[model samples]
Target: MSSRSLPRLPAAPGTIETGSTLKTLLDREAIDCLAHNLARVHRTLNAKAFRREAREGIEPLAILARGQHLAKVLRRHLPARYEQAVAVLVRSLTPSLSETEGNGLAGFFYLPHVSFVATYGLDPAKNGGRDPFEASMRAQYEITRRFSAEFSIRPFLIKWPERTLARLREWTRDPDPHVRRLCSEGSRPRLPWAMRIPAFVQDPRPVLPILEALKDDSELYVRRSVANHVGDIAKDHPALAFELCERWAEGADENRKWLIRHAVRHPAKKGVKAALRLRKLAAAG
Candidate 1:
């Protein structure tokens, strides 16, 4: 959709004038400096769609800064309206974003505030490849974990569940670490911003085998995400996670040790110490 033809966005009620908002933020010397740094980054990136859209008096840098500023300002002054306004603006812009354009916008926005976009996921873009929505979501997921709220991630979590199971098994030999990571990471019940598939969190039976298959995965990133995932399960069901740790602890290397520690992040200290001892024994054996 063309910018001019973009849907009319409702002015968020009680929005302080843009000039006043900018002024207040600039008055804070630290905020001003950070804004300058972020602006420089945005300009250096020279994202095409972002620059073009930025030209209409709303400095892209300022727009980029809006979320962080708004989150702070509105939360203190108008908590009820802050999220609503941000949500409206994001939804209004959704139709206008192309794949790259959307990613560019995602880059401009600060990381902590990515939940505003992930909560919507209104973009029609596909899940992976070069799509901006996909990139944005991946970036958002990597940064924050709370968006794992059930409402936010439910859609992506339940798709072709069996397919994910099959893929995880097949991915161990896929050569591409990205796919390998996806196989383990995407199935995570607490994969930041991803919905908790109760079935997986409750039983995690199917995935236990998959993690076993990929536990010694050569890729650190894949193993890290896998470890964290198992850690998530440990919160909900410790016994299951402990069992998996024991099963995998036989030949523990540093990576395996790290994985076990991560997988048991919230377990009792006794459990953690025991796991460590097991790691030592495995390493020695």
Candidate 2:
């Protein structure tokens, strides 16, 4: 979500593609398209001003920074009430992707929407005494279906750990693979291009349950995230990661074996004997 999703890593900062850059994703045309969607959903939005402000000095900003920029512009142009404003962003989302694979860069269009929630979707005390927790959760749920809420959901985990993790537990069972992937990807202790969750890096127990539920997920898209999340755990708690991988090794399927291998690959490369053995076992499986 910060830049892109799994399988499609975000473009390198200032990465130029055939003379076009990643920031172009939020260019004048993209801004107009975004303005069109928001205006369609909320009749009162000042689309013209939104475009002008969003475009002003936006060219030099990197991809994620651009998202934050437009999000702030949204504050100026949309409803003052957080709930009403978030509702509009949610409703403005284009049709959800039919399948999670091979989506290319189409999902990046909604980056600003999730950025809106992440930057402003925090404590009401800072925001005129109106709590945004419930609305933010609902907004991320919808946004993850289209783009990723992985980047946006991290702040919530930092502010409301127990509350956010509880919501993530429920999301493990969501019908959509993207939502399920967010549950793992969003909570990783060291998610790339996103802020780290210090609590999980210090003690990963809370995140374990969520990963356990998704260890053998029906979709490889979700399960691959589980593997990467475990790798994050390995960085801090190798023993815990190895133990979890050992458990997963029992009654393992081919997909799960892959997860175990991916989960321990980094540690194995670093000469962790246990991880090496585990990787070998997964290979044998």
**Alpha-carbon TM-score of each model against the true structure:** 0.46, 0.91
Which window of 10 residues has the lowest lDDT sum in candidate 2? 3-12
Model 2, runs deviating above 4 Å: 1-20, 125-128
Error of 1 at 165 (Å): 2.1
Error of 1 at 205 (Å): 0.6
User: What tens digits encode model 2's per-residue C-alpha lDDT throughout 209-285?
Assistant: 89989998999999999999999998888888899999899889899999999999998888989999998888853
lDDT for 272 in candidate 2 is 85
Report lDDT (Cα) of residue 93, candidate 2.
78
| lDDT leader | 2
lDDT of 1 by residue, 61-150 (tens): 453254444334322321133333233233322222222111212222232234344433434332222323343334333322211212
